[model samples]
Target: MTRTRSTWSLDSMPDQSGRTVVITGANSGLGAVTARELSARGAAVVLACRDMSKGEQVTSSLPGAEVVRLDLASLESVREAADEIRGRHERIDLLVNNAGLMMTPRGVTQDGFELQVGTNHLGHFALTGLLLDRLLVTPGSRVVTVTSLAHRWGGGVLDFDNLQAERGYDSMGAYGRSKLTNLLFTHELQRRLAEARAQTIAVAAHPGLSRTSLARYLPLPVRPFIAAGTWVTGQSAAKGALPTLRAATDPTAVGSAFYGPSGPGETRGRPVAVGSSSGSRDPEAMRRLWEISEELTGVRPRFVPASAG
Candidate 1:
């Protein structure tokens, strides 16, 4: 876990023998690869997925892996999953907020929030809050959220008044806003953790343009081009997962840090510390979004007052 290498890869990662990791949407795509690699490195991995059967299928072959049902679209399910996880483990070394929705047609979650924002941001937001106590008690715990390059889409705009897409809905626009929210949450959470002087830290990573099931909702006319583009420019799910793995495991990675592919435009390559959109780094916007998220999720993180800092 020491920081000695200039370039990080799977082989450079230190042994994770006693670490416990929980990852959402871990039965497929980047999540699955992340789970497999960590488990292979001797970490006890928990696959938190919407489909228990598929999670079981993935966990069966991974010796120390376990499955837990988790539907990020439903707050109730998130609560249940958190409760189950909290009951089962006294400490959570890492929590990967990897599950998300993409450019799907307009829809609402079970909790009445827009589907993209609900599943992509609010769900992870709520889950992190619920499990934070466990993380707080665990030394060196970290929360890694997966964002996207699409965060720069829609001009990096986040309209507070229209969080639920109540005014109008453009699928890609909403998705972009949600990704932006992910960064906001990560930055704000890291701030609060630092203020509290907590042992836990918050970080973020993006897979760049990996070819995953997330693009399944693309328009038919664009599907072929996207598929071809994946072959030409995108990395595989395993390769795309390097940033996440580095963010989650790198001993040198600090709170508010972001990891992503090092290639041109950050589309594909080895993992490295990366910068996010200017919008994502806005302190005022991050604070406002944090307040709104706490109000909507009705779960406030327990942090020592900043005056104590």
Candidate 2:
């Protein structure tokens, strides 16, 4: 019998009882909404944030929810959080790489990597590698990484030589590069999972033009224009959280597929399977980025190729 594609929504999510989910940036915006909804559905949710006070506040309001201190910009903090998570749970049902920085003023992580790439890509890369074993041992586990539509501006070139933007820095350019790396990492991870015949699936999602705190760093001159644009073209944080929730819970979602808004230019609407830029699908680039991430994070995945197995 042929299966029909059903319209997906938060109401369509399967019961998440007995599942454990870890979400970064759960203190506010899209991540917060995702955590609230998941926890409402009977899942045990971990609110991973850099600010303990904010994390505790959010965690206290939700049932079966707890807080963990995770500063993605610092590798040391990432390791400590991973060890704590491992000690608490033997298996993780879902991991949402949801925390990120937007076009902020140029800065560097504690590890000396570009702020955007460090927090958005490399940090998640290391965290996933550290938790991979638990994911592999659990049935029907998933890794959902949040990317962005700005990735189109990446132009398919990731200048590894100047990844830190030492020569020059353009806030938007750096942001775009980091978002593009997210897709590259997602694709590469899916490939490795397929090769290893692992049960854990890797997928990506974009929030489109959501009204979130992520835009707090917009230049003052552009603030009015952004405000108008968002007012007219953007969706609420709850709606923006749809694509991510769908990627995390949709039974039909497949590894390597990207989810985003279904409206014109993917600006706003219900979540749906969307197309990514051709450059985002370049296999060689994905592989190279993976190598660089592993080297930078020093966290190697425990995957064994199916042939080797």
Please give the distance, in angstroms, between residue 136's alpha carbon in candidate 2 and its true position after superposition: 0.6
Off by over 4 Å in 2: 1-6, 304-309
Cα lDDT tens digits, model 2, 64-172, are 7888999999999999999999999998999999999999899999999999989999999999999888788777899999999998986756667777778899999
Candidate 1 residue spans exceeding 4 A from truth: 1-6, 304-309
Q: Cα lDDT for residue 152, model 1?
A: 89
TM-score of 1: 0.95
Global lDDT of each candidate:
0.91, 0.89
Model 2: weakest 10-residue lDDT segment is: 1-10
Residue 154, candidate 2: C-alpha displacement in angstroms: 3.6
Candidate 1, residues 43-70, lDDT tens digits: the string is: 9999999988889989989997989899
What's the lDDT of the predicted structure labeled candidate 2?
0.89
